[model samples]
Target: MIDNPKIKTIENLLLNKRVRLVQPKNGYRVAIDSVLLAAAVPARTGDKVVDLGCGACAVCACIAKRVNGVELIGVERDPIMADMARQNMSANGFTGRIETNDLTNLPCTWETGQIDHVVANPPYMPANRAYLSPNTKRLTSCVEICASLADWIIVAQRCLRNRGTITLINRADRLNEILSTLNRGFGSIVVFPLFPKAGRDASRVLVQAVRSSRAPMRITSGLLLHEANGHYTSKAEAILRGAPINL
Candidate 1:
C-alpha cells in the first residue's frame, strides 16, 4: 500500500465487517450497489475477474472474501482512488492487482479473451442530464467523465473469454441502455431489480450476462430491500451481510 499522508480518509467495513477499507472521507464513499454487484458475480475457484472503475476496491475485496481462489484485477482512472483501492486490497489481505488506468484505455498487459468474469458498477448519471457535483471524486463517481456505458461493455467484452460472465449494477432508469450495450457481446441476461419497498418502483437493478451466449433473457422477481417500517428485510439483510445473491 502506498502511503498518502495528504489524503484524508475514513475506515469502513463490508461483508458484515469482515473486509476493511480506507476511503476518501469527503469523496464518494463505498455504496451498497458495489457490494450487490460483487455478490451478483458467480465466481468459482480459480476464476480470473476484473472490476472496472473499482473505487477503493470494495467490490474486489467483497468477492475475494466470499469466493476462494479467485484472482482479481481492478481498473481505476483516478490516482487517489486507485491508491486507496490498492491500500484497501492490502488492508483486507486480498491478493488482487489494482491498475491506475482508465477502463477505455487499459494497458497492453490486459489481454483480450483471457479473463473469466468482469464486474463493474459504473457511474449511472449521464453528464448532460444529471447534476455534476463540484467535488471531483463525487462527480466522477456519479457521472461518466471518462467512459460511457458502451465503452465499459466494450472493454469488459474485450477482456473476457467466451462464455465468461459480466455483472453490473446501475440505475433502473438506464436499464434499457444497459441491455442494449450488453447485447453487443453478451447474452443470457438476467436482471434483478432492487426495490426500496414492496410496492415501490425500482431505483436500482443488477444485470448479469454471459459473453457470446445465445440463451433467452430472464428477469427475476427482484429484491425488496425494506419493509413498511423502513427496515431491511431478512433477504436483504442476508445479502448485505455477505450471503451469496441468488439470481
Candidate 2:
C-alpha cells in the first residue's frame, strides 16, 4: 500500500515463503550484494555466523540457505530493520537461531570472540550526500553516518575466532581499501572480481579472509555476471540460485 519509492525495504522469498523488510519504497533496498556476499565464501555446518549491518535480513537469510544449522545473528543499527529481520527469519523457520541484535547491545557471551564467521555488504557511500534519501532510515542504509568500514572490521575481528573467515562484497574500485583493511586485521585473503558484463570493467568484487591464516593471498578467477545481450551469465545464475562458486 505504500507508494513512497524512497522507502528502504524489500519483499523477498528466502526459504520459500514471502517475507518483507523494513524498507518502504524507492530507497536502497536489497540487491545483488546480498547474493554475492553470501556466496563469496564457503560455509560449514554448525558455524557461528554474524551478518553486520544486516538490512532486512536478506544476507542472513541467504547465508542460512548456504550453511544450514549455523547460528546466525543479524545486526542492524536501525530498529525497524531489526523487526523486519526477525520477521524474515521467522518466515524462514529460523526464529530461534536467526535473531535480531545490535552489536552494541549484544550479550556478553556474544560480544566476545565466539563467532566462527562474519559476513557483510556494507554501505558504499560516505555520508549525507545530496542523493541520500530524505527518509532517515533509508539514508543510513546507503551511507555511513553511523558505522564505518573500520568499525565493521574491528567488530568482526573481535567476534571471530582466531581463524574465522570474514567475507565481504564492495565496489571494485574499493578493492585496495578492502584489502588494506583485511590485511591489517586478518590474513589468508581471497578476492573475486564480479563484472557487469563480459569485456566490461569489473563493477563489484568479493573478498574473504581468515582471522589469522598464514596462507598467501589468492585471487581466484573473476566472475562475469552478464553477457553483451544483457542476459545473466550461467555463472551468475548459478550463484544467485544458491549454487557454490569455487574458490
Candidate 3:
C-alpha cells in the first residue's frame, strides 16, 4: 500500500499478473493502452529506453518484465505519479529511475542522441478541443496541458540516437498530425491500428518511426482487440500476457 496520506492508491495486476502495478485509486488508472504501448516497443537487451510522461511507470514496469537487462528511464510531470512509479519499479524488482520533469523542459543532464529507443503514450485529446475533466490529475493525463503532441515528438527526436526508433500510441484520428510532425526528423514509419472488433473502426493507432531513415511508410493489417462477443482476440490476449510485438 502507498504510504502517502494525500493520494489513495490500489495495487493491481498487469500482464496476466506478471507485473504488479500500484496506482491512484481515483485518477487516471493504468489501462490496456499502456500494455499495448509497452508491447509495441522493440527494445533489446542493453538498449537504453526512455518513456516520456510515464504515469506510475506502467510502461516501464511492463517493458522491464518483457526485456531483461535493458536500461529504463521514465519522465513524469506529476510528483505523486513519479513517486508511485519509483515504488512500482522497486516492487516489481526492476531497476530504473523516475525523473519528475515536464516533457517540454527535460533535464539538461539527459544527453541528446543517447537513448536507443523512446516510447510515449501521450495525452490523446487536445486541451482546447476536448472537454476538460474537473479532476486535475485525470485532466492532465487525458488532455494535453503544458505540451502538445508536436512537443512530445520533438523531445523524442532530441533524445533518440541516429537510426534509433521512436514508438507511440495515440488516437487513430491523429495519424495525420503524428505523421506530419515526424516527417522531417524520422522515416521508416509504420502505422499499426488497433480495431476494437472485426469490421469496426480503429480507436487507436500505434506508429513507429526510425530517426533519420528514408524508408517508405507502411500500414499493417491491424489487430482486432475483441470478438463480436466482446472477448479478447487470441493475438490481443498474447500481447496482454507479456508477448513482445514488433510494430
Candidate 4:
C-alpha cells in the first residue's frame, strides 16, 4: 500500500475487473493501449515474460489473467509506480515481481537470454521533438526521458532469449523508427495497426518481432478499434475483456 499522503490515487478495473489497478490520480494512467499490448503478446504456459516500463503492471495483470502459468516480470523506473504494480498484481492473485529500475540500465540480476518474451508500451513522444509536461511522473511516462525508443528495444533484446519475441505498442507515425531499431537485432516482424474507425488512418500500431529471426517483415490488415458511432468494435471490446489477439 502507498503510504504517501501527498500522492493521490484512483482504483480502476481492467480486463473486465480481472485486474484491479491503483494508479496515481494526476499522472499518466493506464489506458486501453496496455490491454491491447498485453493481448498481443504470444506467451504460453511455462514461458517467462518481461514487461519493460510496466506502469502499475496493467499489462502483467492482463497477461496473467489471460494466460495461465506464465512467469511474469515487470521493470518500472518510478518507485511509487513499481509499488502500485506490486499491489495490483497481488490484488489480482497474480504472482510477479516488479523491479524498480530504469529500463535503459537494467539490474545485473536480469540474466541475458533468459526471458522468453518481452513486451513494452514505451513512451511514445521523443523528448527532443515533443513538449514535456510539468508533472515529473506524467512527463517521464508519456515522453522519453532517460530512455529513448531504441534504448528500450536494446534492453528488450538483451534480456530476451534467442527466438524469443518482443512486442510493443507505439504511435503509427513512429513506425519507421520502430522498424529501423528493431531490424538491427530482430526479424520476423509483424506490424499491426490500430485504426480509430473505418476508412480512417491508424492512430497506433503494435509491432512484434522475434530475436535473431531471419523471416521477412509483414504488415497485417490491422484491427479497427471503434465504430462510426464511437462505440468500441466487438474485437476491441473482447480484447478489453481479456481476449487474446494474434499479431
Better of 3 and 4 by lDDT: 3
What does candidate 1's lDDT look like per residue over 1-247, in tens digits? 2446868888887888898878888878988888888888999999999999998898999999999889999998988888888888887778988888888788655768899999999899989988979998899999988889888888899899999999989999999999988878788999999999988999999999999999999999899989999998999888889998977
lDDT of each: 0.89, 0.73, 0.92, 0.91
The window of 10 residues in a row where model 4 has the poorest summed lDDT is: 1-10
Model 4: per-residue lDDT, tens digit, 89-145? 887899998999988676655759999999999899998888889999989988988
Error of 2 at 79 (Å): 1.0
Residue 216, model 1: lDDT of 90
The 10-residue segment of model 1 with minimum total lDDT is 1-10
**TM-score, per-candidate, Cα-based:** 0.96, 0.86, 0.98, 0.96
TM-score of 2: 0.86
Which clashing pairs does model 1 show? none
> For model 3, what is the alpha-carbon lDDT of residue 184?
80
| Top model number, TM-score | 3
- Candidate maximizing lDDT: 3
